[model samples]
Target: MAPNFSPDAVWAQCCEKLRAELPEQQYNTWIRPLPPADVQRDGDTTVLNVRVPNRFILDWIRTQYSTRLEAILASVSDGPVRLDISMAARPAMARPAAPSMMPPNAQGPHSLGTMGTALPPNALAARASGNYQGGINPLPPSAGPHTVVLSEQGEHPHNVVGLHGGQRRNGHPQVMGLNPGLTFDNLVPGRANQMARTAALHVAGAPGHMYNPLFIYGGVGLGKTHLMNAVGNALLADKPDARILYLHAEQFISDVVKNYQRKTFDELKAKYHSLDLLLIDDVQFFAGKDRTQEEFFNAFEALLAKKAHIIMTSDTYPKGLANIDERLTSRFDAGLTVAIEPPELEMRVAILIKKADQEGIAMPEDVAFFVAKNVRANVRELEGALRKVLAFARFSHKEITITLAREALKDLLSIQNRQISVENIQKTVADFYKIKVADMYSKKRPASIARPRQIAMYLAKELTQKSLPEIGELFGGRDHTTVLHAVRKIGGERAKDTELNQQLHVLEQTLKG
Candidate 1:
């Protein structure tokens, strides 16, 4: 028999259970936006309708979390209710009150406090309008001198100041420059970034205590920004009123320039110096800018004086930063520094699969390896290739297969396969001969330069698809006859002269490598 229950009460109880069971990101991504549409009965069977924003979310929840949700609902209603999670034709209106100005993304943060003070799903992103309209579970009136400023485009949080040169009265600083989606749970750890992730976790757990100035450096798209955001999100979860600020070094420089223009140095100092945590991305931009460096140095000293946590990211290690102030570089080196290396082949394949899972895409293992093997640059390129494949599949209305991926990334794969370029060949030949790379293309007729130049021309013909004319153009615009002669001479000598054969073989391997 179907148990009689109020739909609203049953859903409320289910949400409480799911929030406790799932990770915060999982809760936010799958469950938080779900609004109960209706409950009905088909003979003895009971059904619960929950509205979703799009087909992807509906399908994801159906496949991944349906069984778990069914169990939770069964426990709450004393029997299983057929969960009818569906995509709404239009936005539903039967939701809790929210600001008129919704965030760009339909799914935003819900300030539903803890278990005892759970609110409706519509309560999500109530702070979307730059105001924290907490109806049930409200924050304090003030958190020291920091003001709760809603982040813009997940960029830096604006530090709102009060009229009395003190804290704002509206709310405490719940500033979050971190993306809600980038959490520790979603981050896959491997040998490449394990130490960085571990240190980030430590800093998140005890900010300003252990790693006062945690510095993370790595190449592009290696998850440096993601780890920093994870730390910021963890800190926010721990202390809702924590004053957190995140921005790029360019943004910091812009702030300094603007403050100087407006003659508002005092306000700028207050905004940056009183933070519980400050995060800066791509600090390599801070190099060669004296005024910006001076301003940041002052703010850095001030924040340190107050024991505020500071985390920074860069493309290079601290000492590698050229033209920067020595004092600033010294401060950067004082704290813990961690580097995230490029992921290995296995790890790349793992990242592709994990990203596909997050996007609710059913990717075959072979197809993922195909994509991973081709795009070996960094994590960014791997994801970009995967995105292209997904887009092609969606547009062509086909499932992702090895053949489909090849067709999707045909141009990208061509570029990756031709790794040996004429310029690289020139450099390799010149370096092997212990001569400057310019000597390969120079008009010098010395045997040292001429032999290496001829070998480079031969490599261009063998290792690349360039025609003789094109090869000639690359070598200081010589005629195609000169290129053909060089290739013929090298071919004949490679078989007759043992020394030349060994050198040609070594040069070929170097060019390919």
Candidate 2:
């Protein structure tokens, strides 16, 4: 029964308001065609409750439209109407007799859909039983025999041969192939990346069902992308047709720009939603680009609706995506997050030996260690260093000894070494000694500053090629002998004092890493 305030009329007005309130792309993604959730008058404030599909969508709405929502409600309602943004429940799965104790992953405030029926009863039961593991899914075909559809009721995994027949794309994704050998199996795991690798394996084995939004973060050259590809490969291996779509946040941005430019927004949405498995890399790039962030927020919800598995890799958690909308950040936090660290020395050595053997190069133990120790812990850099040494050895007909290896790749280390100028050394020492750079050269006779000043000089000598007089000049025109004395004292202390030695060792490692 329609109240004196017509529900359909209210929804129509709400839709119109949404169009006026949001950007065209956003309105189309979140509001167009989707009817308004039931509107109920609660007290003086009619609390217009809008059921959002997922927290990501809900968050995006709140961030970009919360204020507009209140105004929209104000226009439709008798007076000011408070907005109750919520994740609509699956109507097919009846509300539990008692309150359904949400699983750890579903405890978030947002739901999977705008209306309470996006998830089917079967999917809810599957989640509730905790017995069945949602296995792999096939890649989408173009209007093929078995097409997965998401509704609010019960979900049943459909197969081809008779059901919805979606066809496979002949050649849509024109992206180049990533390194075939960089899959998860090839990664040499150690303490630094053991946890991250394990999580990725779990995701690869169990797509959307295991980790709806699996997050892997680490510095550049870390195996973030490698683990992502490994999972993609594993998923593809289990289900060859698994529509595995991989793109960086930058590429996503490009797509957004193209779609917006060409007015092919529908095509863009279709292209992304069609993937059975979505793998996003360098998600951090979405932080600064608002339009790209909005596009992704929609793609995420649509895929989740179809039970499509999503794996994202980044240098920071969604929450840390600066310049990104808070709601988007919150949605990213809805999933399990794991981080990868730079490979440890042992891991690096194993990786090097593995690569060397693969390349038919017998890298000596010392050479391997030297390569592993000096180059950044990233596998790509490790491989590059190995290739350089092998090329030099192959062309010049010389074994890859420490000297030869050093000569072959002095350029890389040279720039890296040159970065730590005298000022940098002074600053690094001052930071370590809890002093200021001014104090290093200050006429102040305090031993506190003088001791640190000495270490800086010593590090400058070892790390940089600055002459003694040059080093002396950098230290406020001190005599060469004084600079030399500082270096010798710190060097001596490094040898005798374990703590001091450890600190020096750590500093040396930092300069190299």
Candidate 3:
């Protein structure tokens, strides 16, 4: 309560508190690097301004530590205090040298030679040329019992050991956790995944040059994982020894936890930071796990500093994720973020036919169309329906036909029909946006109500077998032109607005359920 209270003293006390409460590595990585605060007074409010070296640290501190820092300031200060975090300016002449991408305990490249397959002679040149080869070094023979050997046919055992047990040959790890079967050649392209696939292909062709940390997101079974794997496979094909690893987000979390328990962060860094590319799936699972986020953040920074590419998939876009640190999410959004929408009708038909051909079954075009029309949720469902139809044809000793397809997919068709009525869509959309269902029919024009109503109209037209006039009639007798307008507006915006597209995806999934 002293009039001459020093903000520096308060900040010092806050740092001491954080140091005591947080793990040593976390405190050192995040808190100790922060510059001193510049505190001032304006209109009875004490403003504490903190500057960080970069946007990453600024976002990290603001999201993870700002509230606690503010509380500490308020507790120590006499009046209300506000926190303002910003990036510090870098002086051109005196800017600090970039930190080594190597881990703290690592001596040199030779330090890792004992752990896995030895690096090739041209490894440095390849890395500098953006053609880096090899993934994490395979564990020593004594480290594990299983040894995964990559086959020439691009097939590996289903129960292949994890990343570390892969075989070593010609001084390169043979298995980089990639499924060679999932490649760009086999992945059917469509408007739904066109943008995402293009970005992925760019990353594959020239890793770490553009779209660094490429992010792909969408609903379940919509080919997010397939796209990520395709990128890794493409890179591996170009440089057989390229260091690449593909894994789900939970696997990374497990690695973090295991290393944390063993106090072996150096090994963790050596494995992940040395890669040419990282393809991770479903990063939304990283939510709420502080230690994992911190470690992943470290790996992410190291890879980028070394110009290594990273591809991550999630059920939602970066900003749409929950319980994740702002710094990580911000980094996730730093690169190109694309969505794999549910396949369109033509694309779905194409997928069914292609997959059937791959199975050596001659799928009639009409049957493919019939299956595509009914199984509109995603490619996975489309594949499942194709399998059912194929099996029914084989067992019944008949040619593949629409009549057979209908009988095969009767249950799915019934479920689809039972769900997703216009009324159900209106109710779901209203509940999602926290508006009244009646607002869909009412003349309310506020954005909050109108947006959800328009979304409902669009879904009605897409999901139900309703024409424009019929949909309009269901929506409180609105004009067919209004219904068409809503559909067109939402359809156009859905392609451009990531947030709206995500919202619509959620509503569609809920209605389909």
Candidate 4:
């Protein structure tokens, strides 16, 4: 006789295991919010249907937790287990109730008098004409100064002087230019962004606490902006009334110019100095602008003084920035500084599959790998390549496959192959480290030369299809074991050494370009 199988019980056990295995924040953010799985039996297979709120969560779970979940399910069950993840259907909106026909003295379901509330004549007219805002109550002129209170369940109520000012349609304050679509739920975590992501999470959970004035620097299209937006969105979700703003450094410059022309510097101070959080991007643009830097420094000092958190991003680190005032740069570096490196191979593969899944097309793992291998620059390039392949498949009416992907991305692949070679890698690495290209093929073993040589070997192995022996032959006739040892050593060190990883990322980007 077989034992009874309860899907909810099994899933609860799995959750207990996951909560123990994962960090509290990660489990709560990703796994804890998930509803119980719906299990069904098909032949000899036990299928567990896992529903997520959005494709971002779906992709994240599929990449990070699906294997572990399946294993846990199998161990707890009596037979084979399969996990299927999909987005849950959105709930239907509730219809509004009809107006009551009761007498003025009678208390009905929609009667505000029963709750000791009375609307102004204009407010009643506005509501009847569908012109009233959800959360704002229009008061008569004689009513004088009125305060509106907004509160979520079990949270302190927020008082607003003018509820009609800058409120969103849903009654919440405008999230200060934050894109609601960008949140921690959608931003995929990987080794490339592990440090930066961790810092962002810390700041998000407790803004104005740790990592205050957090600085995130990275190359373009490397998800720096996405991470910043994610932090802002997370904070906004927790505190609906919190004042937050996200803007480009150029926007600050524009504001400076505008206010300078009008001689309204006080207005500028009033705007930026009152924020609970500020998310700024591309501060490199402030390099040559004296007035912008001065104004930004003022705002930065004010924000820090008031214990408001500030997050900024740029193409390079603070010290690497040129033509910027030392005072401002010092303030920028005063707090925690972190770098977001280019995604590694595994991360690139995960990003490709997740994005492809988001398009409602099931991309085979092999095809995704093929695309990921070829498009190695950044997320933007990977997305562009995926778009081309998807468009090609649709245009040709063919299923997506490795061959089809190759044909679709033939031009990109051709350019990449032509530009990136062992010789190119050797030259790029040599140039970046201020070494000689000839040293790549030399027998010299100086630390300075040997380190770059090992890096070249790693890049050659990673970028090309050359066998270990062939790479050794190209590297001054070294043995295959020596090449393998160099590759392993550098690869391992890259994981542990942040500086070395960043250098490798720069070299890879240069070579790919």
Candidate 5:
């Protein structure tokens, strides 16, 4: 008989894979809260009935997250799994309630909590309509001591907050100077970006959000950078000159190091202190660097005191981040964290079309799908593949077709399979848990050694796409039973344990890494 896969089992695994492949925003909104309804086979293909609260949720999942859904489902079962999203009545099966109003994509203690004093002028202006219905925790209206009373006149339209005490459009705004376009309207909502998009929208209008410090993280090509930029651009429009300075965290560290080297700490402090909005990208780079962490801590403290809005981007969540100091971790935890994962196949196609539209390239749907399939996980790389396919078609005097996409992406397509090797998976799992390679295949039963080994087995099965028997042979002649235990054991643990869920996610990094 075919393997009987439970929806809960699939969902648990989905969370693990989605968190790894997607952002926290995507995870919570698209996958975390949502539960799988049923898994049934359709001829040679598998049909997955995934339920969402409403039509908007279904639509968003179909658009942004479908590719990832397919990839993940493909892994759990042998047959092709296609996602069918629907708005059904609440199921009889008990599921943890989904947070209707979660924290925005990149909110922090200031944005969500009682702390964070330097409120951006735009944020203040947004407070005019009291339209902040989003975020894990909405900022209570009781803040005071400002000479200018918060009111309608302070609210400026077109993403600009023309309040008495707020920053400029070019300036960052802690207030509601959100660019209207940056609202859910301008965002191309799809399965891939839906969760992140929803979380961001909530936070853009809401505050005191639990998804605070919205640590939107993902591979290089995913839209983590895009979503965060949209937040800044949108909010900046609301509060022009609200003191927004967004740069790579590496830049932040370099500046700190430079200041330390040149004795310009005071100047750097002054620059950061003046900001109403601060955005730092690739925060993981600050890991393992004590001085940078110390400086970041100070800057974060100063910003919190000022109530300036802060946003950040990274490849890993605050917890997964290794080598970072504890103080830094605590501060990071003080805010909401959102993650942006790779766009799914449909989203990739949408991205391709969006790019094509931007470039006036007429790409057929078939051609788009072909390109999307090969482009795989990295949103940027996927778009690049589309661009190349278009360019090659134009340059080679050929129409955009499935064949055309294949020939064009012959190089990029090959790149994905290169890293998904057995040895690579073993090493990746080992490196992720900091275990030795010998330990991976050794007979030792230490949970430390065995758990990571199972993770390796799971990864080898998933990433390399090798048969269970093949995977079993790869790990010291361990039979398929061992591989089965790894898959099932990790799946079971992931279902109940959030930490293990996160670790499994970290392991999926092998596919992309």
Candidate 6:
């Protein structure tokens, strides 16, 4: 008989290593709730058993923590240790039954407005009902179609699809590609992302029945993915058993290619069409991919027919998705489309503070403001600046302060402080058009001067936060309506006149530098 081992001691040591390695929120969500079930020795290998509450977590542990947990166990044990994770037996309890495919109360906190009934497809009837095998096993599409099953090539599985006992905790299932950490509760709302966040939360509460397909568009690092994941998590909170798929368009393309090579087209259909909710990021990648778009179109229609909610993110507006099939673009625009503008000053500071809090760092308000003010590009850059400040403080054994932040981000601040003034923009545009800078602020009605000035105005509107009146004042005391007209004119022509567009793009790039 193999000797018994202490599961409690083994798990405690594992937790210690994980707590040190992961962020506090990550540790708390994925590790802290785990219970040590049992331990046994199988020949030279020591096996430690830990129990999770549901299949969702069981797979999450295997996918995310299997190797790390094994190494941690080995480091703390007498010999090599492997983990065996499984779902615990549940006590009978009443679960919030899924509501009929009826319109959710628009006045409800999460619902947006009146939407017709649209439930998930027929495949949702099939659920995963078996013990987790320490490793991922490929199950039929009916059994949680979006569930990430390893392909023997070590690619990350896309999403975990379903629930057992209709219960999950903390965040959504890692379905499709949802990140557990980007919940709606943690997302800071501001003028930039208010509408987008509101629509997302509404979709989360009602799923397919409301906001049948929510389209969120924004520039890079502006929380498009974060909002989509928050919706997925919110849906998971309500319907723990929901089959959700959150994946990038590139991932979808890759999966399609793989299936094509393997001659598994039916499986691809099953995988995507089976979901109760689909959240695809960066659908702009579908541009020029005729075959991929065809497949997606079919799946899209299938999902819509079943009333499955779909959410997609793109870096540009649906109408601006050039080189993409018009049908797909029109379909994308058919739903609730929201734009996430760049965060304003106040929102940026709040984001920095929130990120600092998540990192367990005490960032003085002034320090946060310093970093936020300088890192004005996007949330990603703001977080990066904060990380640098935190790293410097930790290494120097000093507290975070404005002085420390300045010293830590000197180079970044220098680049950020190079303001793109209207004068600089006018000069760049004039030089590019071989016209005089004086033409910018002058009433020069000549086509050459007028066109250049209009382009500059359009660029100002797109790149700066200046009000139309402020911009008009800088452009020779013109009325705000004149500025608006110039902006609209240039914007309309930007798509049609490639040379004009290129000239404006180059001028904008030079001015930003």
What is candidate 4's lDDT per residue for 11-103, written digit by digit as tens?
Answer: 888899999876454565577768888877778776677765433234346545666776676677666666666645544334311111112
Best by TM-score: 4
For model 4 the local lDDT of residue 282 reads 88
lDDT of each: 0.67, 0.62, 0.70, 0.71, 0.60, 0.67
| Candidate 1 displacement at residue 47 in angstroms | 75
- Give per-residue CA lDDT, model 2, range 37-145, as digits (tens): 5667666544455664443344334444555555565567655445566655634434321112123134223222333212312333233212223311111212422
Q: Would you estimate the TM-scores of all the predictions?
A: 0.53, 0.56, 0.63, 0.64, 0.53, 0.56
What is the C-alpha local distance difference test score of candidate 6? 0.67
Report the lDDT of model 1 for residue 247.
Answer: 75
* Candidate 5 lowest-lDDT run of ten: 147-156
Q: Predict model 1's lDDT versus the native.
A: 0.67
Per-residue lDDT of candidate 6, residues 403-453 (tens digit): 988899988655534667777788788887799988888987988689788
**Poorest 10 consecutive residues of model 3 by lDDT?**
145-154
Residue pairs clashing in model 6 are 159-176, 176-246, 177-246
What stretches of model 5 exceed 4 Å from their correct place?
1-187, 206-212, 414-513
Point out where model 6 deviates above 4 Å.
Answer: 1-174, 415-424, 428-436, 440-513
- Count the clashes in each prediction: 0, 32, 7, 0, 76, 3
Shift of residue 492 alpha carbon in model 4, Å: 4.4
Provide the lDDT at 463 for model 6.
62
- The reply for model 1, stretches above 4 Å from the true place, is 1-176, 418-513
Q: What is candidate 4's CA lDDT for residue 69?
A: 72
Runs in model 3 deviating more than 4 A are: 1-166, 169-174, 432-435, 441-474, 477-504
Off by over 4 Å in 4: 1-174, 465-470, 479-485, 492-496
- Model 4 TM-score relative to the real fold: 0.64
- Residues 379-477, model 5: lDDT tens digits: 656666777887898899988888878788777556656767888878887887798998877899987798889888876765565899989888988
